[model samples]
Target: MSTTQNSGRWPHEAPPAGQDRWSWRPQLLSELPLIRRELRRSLVADTSDAAAEQEEELHERLVLLMDELLSNALRHGRAPVAGLVRRTASSWLLVVSDAAATVPPHPDPDRDPARGGLGLRMVADLTTAYGWCSDGGRKHVWAVLAPA
Candidate 1:
């Protein structure tokens, strides 16, 4: 029940999204709900049945991935945190960027999962691929999402 229209491709398949994809520069944590809503609307506007389920599933995964990345960037990394979702014929790319460049992103499976520290692990399992790198003064943690 979303009004957003996909440029021909079912939200799940995500038509060729040129050079830059959906991008966001969230100023406060309070803006996350709005951002999530917009993303969900755009990706699930016209899906149905199995495809709908798949799109919904992928959308949920991306939400969690984005949440973890953004929160981590704000809590641990530096300022100017940004997020983007890119799509091609067969895959979706979720990227989170921040000014922090010293500490690299690591998923410590052995860490306790109660309070926290398990977000990255979840990202690894939920996404088709996951990695992070630092460029200039920015660090980007990216995940590849696809149906299993």
Candidate 2:
């Protein structure tokens, strides 16, 4: 695969063609809370009260997106599941990586309401943008969301 242009200004050189700006492999589900806490610290913000509120809201959205993506990875992927999050000036880029190289599911409008696909559907609707790609045996499903 070739390098595609990223929509944000990240500090590192472009990822290895099909990878993200950063990555992590959570050892256990219990580590998610810690991950969230650390991610909260990585955020850039203003000092105003309004900015604080907006930052809070953005953090909440990031948490929700993280949950959905992680759950999907744990449920559908193979071992050594990983995750990634990048904080840009105007947005957050989040990704859940899995060992499975198979394609990630898209939002299916006609599927059962309570069965499957709702999570991906919610992800698609809630985020500014969403996409997935598999490089070799690693699959990365990612989303971009406004910071505020």
Q: Considering every candidate listed, which one attains the maximal TM-score? A: 1
TM-score of each: 0.78, 0.70
| lDDT string, candidate 2, 2-95, tens digits | 1221222111222222324445677567777777776666543322555776578777777777877887787777767888877566677887
Backbone N/Cα/C clashes per model: 0, 0
Candidate 1 Cα lDDT to native: 0.69
Cα misplacement distance, residue 125 of candidate 1 (Å): 1.2
Ten contiguous residues with the weakest lDDT in model 1: 1-10
For 24-109, candidate 1 gives per-residue lDDT tens digits of 88878888888888878767863566688657777787777887778777777778999888875677888788887666675565
Candidate 1: regions farther than 4 A off: 1-19, 46-50
lDDT of each: 0.69, 0.66
